[model samples]
Target: MSFVHFSVLKDECLQFLTENAPSNSYFADLTFGGGGHSFAIMDLDESYKLVGVDQDPDALKNGAKLIAEKQLGERVELLSSNFSKFPKLIKEKDPEIEFQGILMDLGVSSHQFDIPERGFSFKYDAPLDMRMNYEDDTIETAADICNTRDADELEEIFKTYGEERFARRIAEKIVEERPIASTKDLENIIFHCYPRNMRFGKIHPATRCFQALRIAVNEELGVLTEVLPQLVELLKTGGRLVVISFHSLEDRIVKRAFKELGGKDSPFRILTKKPVTPSKNEIAANSRSRSAKLRVIERI
Candidate 1:
């Protein structure tokens, strides 16, 4: 399987992480989707050691192959787990390993959307399973949510996570048509929920609803909230933390977390007062990167 995610804000991440990094410094790629950023860092300096974690099986499989192919096996350790567990995992792996840089490219990976069976994209008529870690039975799938969650709960999820304006209408429709087995089925319901004149707009009406389902299925925002401080804790005194979030919800969390963690007496400092975005060229090259916003903070 081809994991085809274009790492967003690649150059910006590399520059910030490598700026004050010492020779043989350790780094962590918390969301190692395509291994693009990790590979770039290794290419930048042969001595830099990297530990990459991804809950998705495909990412880990591809990463292992790529790591061996690039002969980065010795320098790069690819762990198969969600980044939310990084703090504990790091301690178990190496009690003294403090990262010089920790990079988190949040939100759904391009590969996840491109793959039809993953049920991330409404473009395909696949099952409604949107679990980031397919093997995790603890978390409910998107279908489970639609099939079991009450109308009010679904409405809140759609409104809060996706910011969908017609969340209430859509949630009611979803409940009325329970057991929405496929992505296309959910997509159609969301489409008709919109006013006829606005139904065929530039963006698909189902986009936000699908996003809401994915977020809920994966508990993305909550997991991000849990991990941001842990990431800060694992950074070395002068280490940098770079995060690229593709949506406002995630960016807001990143912004608030940085502010909370950075202060005069605090051992951290915000590196980007305003979030950095991809250049026009980059956005043109990868349309999916258009919404990406990067923020960096340094451990003081």
Candidate 2:
């Protein structure tokens, strides 16, 4: 069966990774969403070994099939774990292997958002589950956050992660209407929280709330911040690290991390001073690709 995926920025990512490869050096695709970048880079060069990491078990399962089908068994290694744990795992896998190219395409996959049962999309009437790993039984969920978190705490989540200006009012309304049990119910609460006149903005009113919940449910930003410096350290000198972020909050994290690592006195040099967005052609083909911002830096 064909994997349910259309890789974003295929040509662009391939160009950056391949061009920066250290004379056929090893590479790591940290997010490895669809194995598109891993497959492309592995296929482009014979000496390029690959490690593909993902938190979701199902994604790695699909990746296994994709790797075998592509006849990349000799070149690629798949890991079923969070990329935040990547440094320790990399050393565990093979002490001799050091990555020359690392790519992190952050944010939820198309598969996650498209499948209603996963409860990623607010427009879809799915269950409230948003766990990246079905096996990870710990951590608070969107439902728990909505129902259990105080109004002040919930408001801060919306403001920080979602950049929602009406965050405080939304949290107040959510507190009044407790136990938001479904995606639609949560969306409705956010929709009505805003006055009718103010609600009809360019994007849906619930957009930020959903994003905030997903980040919290997954602890995405925290994981990212923890791992950023580690990834820079793991890179070989002159090695390239590419990060693609889909939202402004994510972009900000990536931007700050890249800047700190790329400092002249630091271990790396900046490659993309400004983040790169998708071309008009790519954006036209995939609407979700529009918001993506790609940034790269090289270990000095």
Q: Which candidate is the best by lDDT?
A: 1
Predicted model with the maximum TM-score? 1
| Per-model lDDT | 0.92, 0.84
Please provide, for model 1 over 1-300, each residue's C-alpha lDDT reduced to its tens digit, 9 standing for 90 to 100. Answer: 777888888999999999888899999998999999999999988899999999999889999999888888799999898888989988997898788999999987888888999999989999999998998888899999999999999999999999999999999999998888999899999999999999889999999989999999999999899989888988998899999998999999999999999967999999999999999999999999999999999988
Worst 10 residues of 2 by lDDT: 1-10
Task: List runs of model 2 lying over 4 Å from the truth.
Answer: 20-24
Q: For each candidate, what TM-score against the reference? A: 0.98, 0.94
RMSD of each predicted structure:
0.9, 1.7
lDDT of 2 by residue, 101-193 (tens): 889999888887877877888879976777878567786668878999899999999998888899999999889998788889888889998
Q: What is the lDDT of candidate 2?
A: 0.84
Model 1 residue 52 lDDT? 92
